[model samples]
Target: MTELLDIFRALADPTRLRIIALLREMELAIGELAAVLDQSQPRVSRHVRILVDAGIVERRREGSWVFLRITRDGAVGDTIARAGEWPYAPREALVIAHDARRLAAVRTERAAVAERYFAEHAPQWDAIRSRHVAESEVEAAMLAMMHNRRLGHLLDIGTGTGRMAEIFAPTARRVTALDRSPEMLRIARAKLSGQGLPVDLIQGDFLDLPMAGASIDSVVIHQALHFAQEPDRVIAEASRVLRGGGHLLVVDFAPHEDEDLRALAAHARLGFSDAQIRGWFASAGLLLENTETLEGGTLAVKLWLGRRRSDEDQPPVTQEGQGQRKRLAA
Candidate 1:
């Protein structure tokens, strides 16, 4: 069929295939897609239009910008699977090698673009931080949950800029802000210290926190869980530091069909769904008190509120064969 041939022709190019791979996980604006492909905007747009006409990609408008993502068509999936088997002969290997080099160069350019973006925005992070947080209902719910809790020693995991910590410190006796980035910690320290709040700054990984067991009365993680290399281990660490009856508040974007975030953010997994967060909490010896979906339109946020049970009441982790009861100690 002419349509089928169009699909094949669109995918025959290495650049179009790379775009398909990127769109398989996350929807991207045309400019963002262009940046990733290291191609001119017009060239990327033309390729995307070809793929769209072939029913392999779909476009949606968000405000003035248009986003592209893979179509949810079985035929498209089949086409992709079949295309995976294009046998490249020895001569074709040279072309593949050339393309590999080209892709590497493109990645370097994209990385430079990302670096410039972060660098430019880093200075004004505080001014715009609230805009990002305030836009989400999940953030609001998490803030309300923290407000209602009788927090004594609060620990904010991945506390970039101390935004959540500064918010919690006035109500809690003390707030400890932890982050892996020294630059981010410096910004957080400046923000929290400038407020004259009782906030302690620590630089460390969330999975391997420097805090002692049962040291914190509350733990808050805000839009940062997806960036963790080991989310389960980080949750376990949060459980370990939480005192009995302590609360854990998590706010993050719900999992979308985006694979690019998984690759770009070093995300071990896509953002958590409600069921996944609940399971993680149960495994960490924490009881789920509430889970809610915050309406943020296309950027849906999920909030999970959990409480640690009494230390002795925690579940036991069973070994595969030994049948030994290893307390699910965080």
Candidate 2:
């Protein structure tokens, strides 16, 4: 009964209810939570304590940071279920508005922190971060996408180290690699330039690409979707630049249980499920061709191959374009 009372007390406050909603997607650290709640760390921590005691929230330690997630059981869940039985109240709007403002403030602060981290670490990112999946598989996935295409022009979004570009440059007439980090771009340019490849490097956010609509034949995003602030927007941008029947290949880590990524990267969501990816593609007016899951020792990679649709009632990627000619023979 005490637990139930504690849960009711926690939910009585609008701020705590907002916190619960945020935790539904991913676990977050106290500092990160505070940033999202637009409250002091101590205040967020205090609220979390009540929730924890009520058995509505659970905490786990990852490295030095403690992360919190919604607890399935205990007092809070029961209170929430009970609350649902009540008729709609006029005051619900007021509570929702108050919580929305607080949550917005928290999100704004978290974005600032994330931008600072990305800026500071941009230069040394390649050396500082180790690859969890095999480099060879990454190359193979890119190559597979280029296997049938004419490779007139290719765009690689978030082209860290130019791995995807390196594979595409051999077969592609022109390769444009876009990234936000000048330091990472430097390494990518050095590597691709050394190999005598014709690759153009651009430093920009993937969400706001500088390319025109229907300009590129193929677009590849490798292991970088998890870092996006607005992945759905990025997908739309990718679709916008691709010509009809052009392919978009995305390779990224499978979603797993990781609280640190949620906090540090401000990941709106984790590794995407096929259904989610398909929905995004459909929304963006693209047709899904295939999806492959590649399992590595430490991480799982999901590869999705999708193609832009044409206005005419022609089947996607007709036989003429499906010429079995391998383009990577430079």
Candidate 3:
């Protein structure tokens, strides 16, 4: 009862309630929240602290920036939703409507920042894009491969330009795009935010995904695996988040002698081989279902599609466990 009281007390304030309503729309950093609320940073931080202490909101630190989102555990979210059901002053709605307009300005600011970054790095990106097959053809292949199944809770790993998230968001039940670079995440956020798609852009490492095990249905690592020094660990991490029978799509370059790419482009590996990827899939409890190759300029792109093994497809116990069970029975 005391805990419930604390939650109510924390939410009793109009500023805190407004914060919750804005968060319900999308996750925002302290600065962005302040911009939308038309409040100072310190004041917003105090309100955020109250909400955090009450366990109604959670904060995730990415680099130097901290972002806030409504808590997703248990009935806490439902409780907040219930509170929103209560009658409020008519002006509250109008205030929120005004906030929505301010939010548009914030989005415009984000796009401008992202555009500056893209303009600065356009040459590098264009060089990389020229070596590979046309993105339109690759996207078509990807769509056809997964069109047969529903992408429940899709996770786009290393979502660079947010293209994959944009392509798959309409069909996915839930979309979350993760990238290691803060600048890239901002670029992705700008592209995804305007579409009215509920995408959570997270700044996180691919080797250690900030997601629970067996929670994601579809995972895509498109043209990003080459940047990882330990690609096997990345595959393992992707497999870890996949539910039974979930799909993992890896689109990257096949074997090549592109030493310039490693020296100039920051690529950890020149490319990958079919045998190596299959070995990784087997070790990660994923079955290699399909493989497609697109031959283009100097680099050839390969797509490996793997499916996580379901419980019905795997043994109930390991060999050692089974042996121990037999000895105990005897």
Q: For candidate 3, write residues 5-111 as lDDT tens digits.
A: 88899989989988888887667899999988989999999999999999999998778888898987666777876755767789987887788788878888988
Model 3 TM-score is 0.89
Clashing pairs in 3: none
Give the per-residue lDDT digits (tens) of candidate 2, residues 3-59: 666667777777787677666544466887776666899988898998887788887
Better of 1 and 2 by TM-score: 1
Top candidate when judged by TM-score against the true structure: 3
In angstroms, the error of model 1 at 25 is 48
Candidate 1 per-residue lDDT, tens place, 1-330, comes to 887787788788777877776655344568877766667999999989988988899875533556576765577777664543667566655655554554444445545554665687765554423323344455457677666777999999998767888778888998888888766764564444335677766667887888899989999988788887678778889999999999998887777765655554455666788788888899998999987776534456778889998956755545653343343332
Can you give the TM-score per candidate against the true fold?
Answer: 0.55, 0.54, 0.89
Q: Lowest summed lDDT over 10 consecutive residues: which window, candidate 3?
A: 80-89
Candidate 2 error regions (>4 Å): 1-132, 262-268, 313-330
Sorted by lDDT, highest first, which candidate order results? 3, 2, 1
